[model samples]
Target: MGHCIICGTSVDGVVCRSHQEDVAFRFTGNHPNQLTPGRFYEGTVDGFADFGVFVDIGDSVTGLLHRSELDRRLESLDWDEGDTVYVQVTGVQDNGNVDLSWSIRQSPREFRGEVIDSPEGDRLPDDEPTPTTETEPEPEPEPRTADESRNDEEPEASTNGGSASVEPQSTAGPIDSGPPERVTVDALEESVGERIRIEGRVVDVRQTGGPTIFEVRDETGAAECAAFKEAGVRAYPEVEAGDLIRLTGEVERRHGGIQVETESLKPLAEADAEAVVERLDDALEAEAHPGEVEPLAEDPALADLTDEIADAAGAIRRAVIESRPIVLRHTATADGYVAGAAIERAVLPLVREQHDREDAQYHYFDRQPLEGEDYDMAAATSDVTRMLDNRARHDEKLPLVVLVDTGSTAESRDGIELLDVYDVERLVVDADPGFETSDVADGVVPDDGSITTTVLAANVACGVGDVRGEIAHLPAVSYWEEAPERYAELAREAGYGADAVRELREAVALEAYYQAYEDKRELVADLLFAGDDEVRSLASHVSEQFRAKLDDELETVRPHVETREEGDVAVAVLDTDAFTHRFDFPPTALLLDALFRDLRAEHDRLVVVGLDEADLQIRSTEGIDVRELAERVAERVPEGGVLASGVRRGRLSFLIGEREAVREAASEIAADLAA
Candidate 1:
């Protein structure tokens, strides 16, 4: 046994140092008793170098898999820094290093065993050859000296040249290493104001304060092309974002780390041409169906008008009033009613034509009885007096209209003090004289106008006509049938038509609903305020009246009606204003909420909800807030049962309003689905 001089390791070998110019070898002092050669073992590539790979075989020494042994497919095998590949031991040289290979053409178990033959396959017979006592041949002539051998290794001189092979000189010398590595557009370093080429997908094109910018992208990344001043964008004619372009210019970094600085650009048609064609196709298709691409929020005609009015009025007054139909004991009274529209009331004699004084009087009155009627003149007179105290009060400013018709008897004297003989003043009257002082007045009047002063008191106390209460109160059927011309005339003067009337009537219904809601709110407030049953009683009483009124109005309006009910909620979308006088919001909101609850209970789950003008439903309700309404319903709905609605701002806007609730519900539903 001897130690290796190179690594200080114990080994059994002949100690020899055979260092030839081409190869070197070292051996320890020990010799093998029995040799096992040509044995193969699996190995791991441990290290890679330009010339070969070093593989470990669990022995202290490693093996070599030269580049020449690699598969032809990886011809120029440029191995990565860390790659471990399988290899097999091929041979062990006189030196310590082992030779390895990956090819398995030779089976290890079949071809490897003890060394029985020399390298040239010369065999030793079963018995050793006897050594003849032969004198060794005379020693060969003394070998040449080391210097002589070294000189022989030198290149031989060429016949007509200084040296047999001049060293091949490199045009680029050492610096050329190899052909400079080919750089793709992606590989170039990005620097501000540096002229560099890059590629990316075009994402957007929009105008900034300076010029139009379009985004382009390639495999590496995306970049923005700023078409600086004068909008060189036009030069690119059809060029847009997403159109692959080969831009050439000095790069500039702007707005932080974003890099951009373009002097000239060219569209890389091959890369972006397909996308451009697709965009053109899309644009062509859109042109083919122009109507479909509309912004999401658009109101229906009726709704648009409602929104206009609501905007103008701040808070809209929408109401509906139901009245007992006039049996019209006779047709004889119809002519008098028709003629009454053009005739001034008997109070024309009590009016002064001109007002020269700062405090001139304006006289008006509703001859309709208030003794037992819903409207009390004394109360209305008091309201008028309060209005009169304000300097801003005037006839044109007040918006109520009293429908006056001549009843068989007059109740003005009974309920109104100062029956006659008062100072002369101006008088304002309802445009529709058919309403006169009769029982039909309240029935014809909108539910919301029940608290209004008559035209007489309104004109006398405040210089205004109660157009809302009086003129608009004409019977819908009668006005359209009996006095179409007069009704048209009033509509024209009012700067609207039947459509406006219908809208106003609907608005009135909404107002009444709001009032009903307010009444409930007030009752609740009172109950909460007082902590008593009195307010509750008042609320119940008012609700009963409201329901009865709704019934009466429905009777008149639902003559040619159709209705669909989901639960306790009955949505009777009428074709005319005669349906329950007008649309009121409070009862609608409460009723709808109750209906939803009932549906929830009946179906064992709420199924679906349908609404007309869901936008209006959301817009009109200030209490019970639409957001809260959505939340309340969202909480109770099954994963799939929630159905809220809005047709304006976008179909999803309605959902957006309820995002918090929907998000929560969605998370729960998703979890359930996952489970």
Candidate 2:
């Protein structure tokens, strides 16, 4: 019976067996899976080569059994190109080359092949010679015993295949060691059933009714990590958003989406956080868009804002200078720093100097109504009027500066302040780089009369320099010439003893050296005028004048100048070297703290503020002192604050320098005061 090579079926069983056999010689097909090389297969020889012959299988491509890998010995084999022969798929080279051989052995019937016999079986010869035994003995007949009967049962052997059973693998536990398999930002996509650990900083955090959603961002991008309220509230009492945290969790693709969900989180320390942030920044390339910022000033919204600022400033000045009981419906500072000060300045003097300078009724009304506190406008008015009455009675008028700076903050949307100026009779003044179109549009309503806002372009100081100078020299200039000994004695008692007092004399030399090397300037002039008291005196006067302006403006216009001076004129020495040491920043803070502690012991009621060289204390002052003021100013200013500042901004530098000087004086006098 012939079989179909392609389908592996017997052709004899089919109806068309006779016709199929004729075509079967010309037909071809392939073995299912040819793993071993040098194996021959029977098929029509499709093509020929010097190395091998290609035999066509029923499949599209022919299989080539390489001559080198073949087990056949080809000495002389008469095979036509079209003849059906066997070939094997030999070694498959990476370059898509194939090899073949001719002589090969047929497979056994028991292996996979079927026996092919001749169709015509001739009933010819059945004669065959049988070999005779050489020396055969006599044949004997034996009788079987009754006990050896064939029906007796014999012992049976076990036939069931006894295979060893495999123990099942454990599935219930956490991984012991080694870094968790790292999944990239892209690879995190397909991982649905796996556990993962993500390292990043907590960018944003919000507590919902159910869980706290936190955004953790590394260099690649940000991912969301959620902790249940019960867990998060307990875990994050000491830390907040912007802290560095690591999360380990079973990942669930949210809504079958791509983002990973972390189930647990742990906080990272400052050093670890800093290193991570550094790496992230290196990857992110965070950059400031200076061009973007500059164009913002020319924006239409900014133009409108400038007009409103002018109006607010004009109203404030008129109300303050004219001694009118001003009721500002709305007044806003750009960032609330200066504007807040402006508002306080407007209300303060009415209470302080009102008793003496009563020209008109003095009434001030202020309450942070946002919090629903009832404003005591009436009581404030009575108090102001009484102060004004007293000032008038004493024939004294306090000099006040109406500080007019630019308009609202970059993000402010409130325009009610502009509308209030129109409601009241006041004028507006324009500062440099005046208001934008948006400010004008927002400043007033369309159908109403516009506020009488003036546009003034003048550069005027608030005399704070003069005031600060006067206040600063109050201890020295006031009594220095009259009683130097008494003044020195008082300074020593206040914690600045002889050493600190002596250091003040050497301050000029120190400042000179600082200017020479640090400022990169020739100190020839300073050296020539070294002992010239006249020159030193002039520089001291200039410094005092600048300081006084700040002091006086803050003192007279705003509240009384709150100063925490560590050095006292009564007794002291200055450790100029300690003041100028370029150690890490915190040491500066500590030095200032020690200075303030000593100063606080003496001036129980004074507004103790450090200025100039002793201003380093401002870096770490806890509350609303020079340090706090420095911090606040730094935060409000776009030019980075004291902590985050560069050398050029020098706001912090100025504070630090001033703080260190005060600290030096206090340190020099600490022992003397103790004695």
Candidate 3:
């Protein structure tokens, strides 16, 4: 018996069972079957494919080192044919096809020991020194029976298919070899019932009251591997989510799926861990060339925003690469949802490709629709608090918050400043025309537009160069009625028909109001990019329901509203909080949109003032400088403490805490308009 190299325990093999994955082996066998499933081998580059590189391991084993297996992109590989590299033989199929995985450690010194896997038994390489002992001497030959002599002479023949119980005296384990062969989480299907090695960043770690489960993910896939120290104990207290690690374990079919029983695990250094992420960033960056993108819109303003769009796209790509979470904050409106959905649509696929975990997209990115007109302090506080909690609990990196459709306005300045306190960089892709996003934004897309925020976000998605074509119809969906001729033409060119576009608009608007807070991802994706003609029917049904709800709510509110002429303005007054459902579909904004559309005439300046306990929200057909109006009101009623709260929604709140004061301010403003 030989001693294990890592623990120095006596064993019958080159490495003990406990440290099997810590060792690498070179296959000298003739057939693929003779090569161990979990062992690494030296190989030569045979060829390359779009999916992976073909590697010739030995005389009979040629395996595919899939692009998904590499820590880097296939395009970045600088290897040529006949060039030597190292890979792990993860599996050998029944048809004799071999599957290979990439190794993070390429040099021989990285491994604990190397052994030759011959047909008869494992042995030391010819270049390596044989194991020697000081205390326990080598065994001498002893008398044996004729049958025993024959069996000893032909151990390979005796064990080939026969019942000869000859345990080959392979010298005990070698020194701490490096980590075992790295396999993709997806490749475990072929390796069921076999011991294998895999390397990945720990996506999640949880305890089952029995064993600690680590959800590890390589580029290709993710799986849960369990480690048990004892009953009801935490196996690896130091192991946490987001740690890059290499593990050796047995792949077993558990719960009708493949899971691993981990034998050993090692955390990889951050410097070495950068390889996998750096490769993904390179691929994402290559896709962002200007030549790859065609046109956002015919408008010169949209054209000018291209550079800013590209910058934001690059930042997003880098965040995903570095495994930093991205928090998407958008206004809770149809325009905002459309914009947020477009970015979400673009980012999820890349997240799935770069990281192996199925849930990494959810973990790495967030699509939270902001309430009201501006990303106010309350919203920012909640977002910062939740993000900090996640960072503390999961050891997650500080998230990059992308403000969609809201942060551009001056109203969001205070909220933006609060996020900046954490040193969090914020990017703003706003469709608002009135206010500049300069002071608070790290990256800003500046342009004037009645164009829906989705179109702007879509342009940003395309700026990334990997934008999905399926989102081509989403911009059309963002428009409630008259889509600009240029945008409509572009949408038509992208295959969005008039009916589908309208249906998508109705459906998204309705969905946006219902769960006004949640992103409603799968539902939105299904409604927007159903990939079939029937999606039109699906969107139409939801849109009709949305419109019907709006119609009923509009009629109900009309009785409570009072309309009268006040100087140059046609003022409509309504007690919003008393008449409208506080938490229901058809938001006050949408209802007012319909009211403004119906009441406005070419010569008439129609203003609708909605009042709720000390809050006044005003919407007008003709443009009103609400900030200037608020200044006027603040000057007129200094005791009221009436200040502009949300510029995007024309919202202002009174500090005096009285409903009568809000009505007085609204009345005074309508009358002051005579000036």
Candidate that beats the other on TM-score, 1 or 2, i.e. the better one = 2
Which one wins on lDDT? Answer: 3
Alpha-carbon RMSD, each predicted model: 37.5, 35.9, 15.8
Model 1: lDDT to the true structure: 0.32
Q: Of models 2 and 3, which has the larger lDDT? A: 3
TM-score, predicted candidate 2 vs. hidden true structure: 0.21
**Tens digits of per-residue lDDT for model 3 on 292-359?**
34556666666666667767887777677656788999987878888888888888877887666546
Best by TM-score: 3
Regions of model 3 farther than 4 Å from truth: 1-9, 12-17, 20-293, 434-437, 601-603, 655-675
**Where does the lowest 10-residue lDDT sum fall in candidate 1?**
317-326
Alpha-carbon lDDT, every model: 0.32, 0.33, 0.71
* Residue-wise C-alpha lDDT for candidate 2, range 373-464, written one tens digit per residue: 11123322333455467445532222221222222221111232332333323222222122332342222211111211111111000111
